[model samples]
Target: MKIIAKNKVAYYDYEILETFEAGISLMGWEVKSIRANKVNLKNSFAYFKDLELYWSNAHISLYMAVKGDEQRTRKLLMHKSELKKIHFKKTTNRLTLIPLSLYWKQGKIKLELALAKGKTKYDKRQSEKAKEEKRKIEKMLKNYS
Candidate 1:
């Protein structure tokens, strides 16, 4: 699978509990744009309205050849049972549904969604410190080798 766009902030800001692979409903022009790697997942999230899931704030740059909105709300295709499960988790557990990455899988575009809880300030700081220490260890190993 080739990743077209990723929401890097999702990992840093949320602790993921579960992940789901979902298909996205896209316009023809949007599909073309995605194939060209003209997509953004930052500030984007999934929400349910009337029991249907929709993607909001995700940006797909318009194809020069087509006329369409760049930031339209797109539908997410998932099974009814799956949707109900997600809805249950979201409403009862207070978890969030975040789009982690957009990628091409077997010639079809797929979205990786995560069930997550927002990280606290202290958690973020701890992660940052761990990252720093990991970097230092890697650098030291590289120098030694």
Candidate 2:
């Protein structure tokens, strides 16, 4: 799949437990905007309202050539079973539905959503420490070799 836009903050703010790929419903202008790589999923999230799943806070810039509303809520297409699974995890496990990335799969736009739990400040600090230590070890090994 060819990626269009990615939400980098999602990885830093939450611990991703599971990921799902789902189709996106977009207008022609929005599709064109995405092709030009003018989309942002950084502050976007998924939610189910009235048995339908929607993505909000995702920005698709105006095509400039096309005229109309630019910031509309986009619909996410997923199987009923998948929707049920996401709902269950959200309600029972206190997990969040975060949009991780947008990509082109077989010419259609798809969204990658993750079941995530927020990380605490201490957790973030420990993760940074672990990463630094691992990097130091890798550098040391490279130098010795």
Candidate whose lDDT is highest: 1
- Candidate 1 residue-wise lDDT at 86: 95
lDDT of 2 by residue, 91-123 (tens): 899999999989999889999999999999999
Off by over 4 Å in 1: 141-145
Give candidate 2 misplaced runs (Cα > 4 Å). none
| TM per candidate | 0.92, 0.96
Candidate 1: give its CA RMSD in angstroms.
1.5
lDDT, candidate 1, at 54: 93
Q: Clashes in model 1: which pairs?
A: none
- Taking the tens digit of each residue's C-alpha lDDT, what string does model 1 give over 1-145? 9999999999999999999999999989999999999899998999999999999999899998777789999999999999999999999999989999999999999999999999999999999999999999999999999
